[model samples]
Target: MQNPPLNEILIGDCREVMKTLPENYISACITDPPYNYEFIGHKWDNSEIQRRIEKVSGKGNKTLVKNIPYGSGLAGGVRNKKWYQRNRHNILDYEKWCFEWGEQLFRICKPGATVLVFNSTRTVAHVQVSLENAGFYARDMLVYKRSSGIPKGVNIKQQLEKKGYEQPEKWDGWHSCLRNEWEAICVLQKPLSNNYLETLLEYGTGLFYAKEQFGGFQSNILEGIQRDKTEDFNVHCTVKPISLMRKLVEIFVPRLENSILIDPFTGSGTTLLAAKELGINYVGVEIVPDYLEIINKRLDGISGLQGMLPLSE
Candidate 1:
């Protein structure tokens, strides 16, 4: 395979792109694949609607997690049995999609390599199960607790009152779901060929650096108080904070000279940028050409990273 180029974003679908890489080429993976749920803010107007339409569906640049149309029964229009059935079907499809790339990832990473996948708290279990089915072991689930989050669920009492239902007060203060404060990080690992120490000696993997940046041990729950610094150069709607990505990379990625970290769904190139900032090697795959350009721009702007990257720095 001649070894895919390092520290660069490959512009193609990860499922196909990863197949071309040599087996066991990557040491660790830190990625946030599509959540497969189609959505936009409900409080948007015509102008915002048009912008989102152009961003996700225009020009055939639909390689995003929200590839499914907004009004599809699968994506929540009415809460009928048909909608539930459609949603379940899409959920299954999403799990299948996860496995397709996860299998390739399992083949490309060394035994004992870790994969940290950020996804919706509701669906992270599906991601874990799909990767486990693809020959990786589910290790632990990490939580990223945000300082604030929007409550996107529908208010039950308001809807009932609008419908003139009897005793809408019965559903006072009720909503469909909780506030979207925390997200799930599905921690997965390729099975080791030997004991942890032996695998560490042989493959330079099979363990994590447990030391925390703030001091003491690394906890499963990651609390972030820093504001997003990607706002300067990033247009990706779901750009993770550079602080979060760097911490994940520091803990899960090995420091061996030849070791490489990868982000199969390198949205806005945050993972690659984090790895580079830490003197680690990285390779990335982004299916969207528009985002690939954005990634290159972000990477090229790395010289100002200490000021323009994470709010922490």
Candidate 2:
């Protein structure tokens, strides 16, 4: 099938949805897929958590709830009451799902197309191996880092309470040990007879926007872009930061002049929005209805997307 409407959101499983598209249709894919665990939540909803926080501090204080979700580290493990059991159908089948979807992804991607899959330390190896076995070449393994200036939260109130202070000040909430970022971007490229430059030409349409900002070293490992909840989707699964997505597009899948970006696991449509800002075409498939709504709202206020058509057509 021809790809869905450009700039629109398709609500469905990516594995099933991507199969409908034509081969070699996408120039590249920038994805932050679900981590196979249901606990990760749909798209990082921390409003309830923030509300609790604000209640703890005073309703009028914005600073008190600022870091409620992103905190000093990745949020706690996703808690699904039925996760470990086999009674109900769960995406937690981990390796099986990884390999199955990895194969599907391999099939859909164009030859020499680049894919950047983001994951945490725990499942990084599984993702890497699955992709490799499915025939994608692993080009690089890079960490997404945060600045050392930021504090962590491994131990805040306990230390302060031990010292006889009733409560550790908010700044004290910053963990002394800088929190290592939770996600890693594993870059892969499909094998092709054509040269790498040809592949770059096909994908680098919007790369110019981030090239000069990289300070000479074209390292794939990125750092310090915090996910702002205010600008983020409230879905349970953690969404990747838009700045990080922009850099990923520029560095890996440079925008192709005539082609559209495709994101199968388009959580909250971060990839689509990034494509919009870069003046590229895009198709996003989201499995969750709430996330699709979030994507629409995000696209609505973007001035550049004023006349763009939704991919759901």
C-alpha local distance difference test of each model? 0.79, 0.63
**RMSD (Å) of each candidate, 1 decimal:** 6.7, 8.1
Candidate 2: tens digits of C-alpha lDDT, residues 36-73: 44323333334544454656575564432323333322
User: Number of the top candidate by TM-score?
Assistant: 1
Candidate 1: 10-residue stretch with minimal lDDT = 304-313
Per-candidate TM equals 0.85, 0.66
Q: How would you encode candidate 1's per-residue C-alpha lDDT over 1-313 as one tens digit per residue?
A: 6647888788888899998889988889999987757322222223443555676665654433333445554544768888788778877888888999999999999989999999888889889999999999999999999898766678999999999999999999999888788889999999997789777777778898898657899899999547576556565667788888888887898666767899998878988888877777789998766677778887776752222111111
- Which sections of candidate 2 miss by over 4 Å? 2-5, 36-92, 147-179, 197-211, 229-237, 305-313
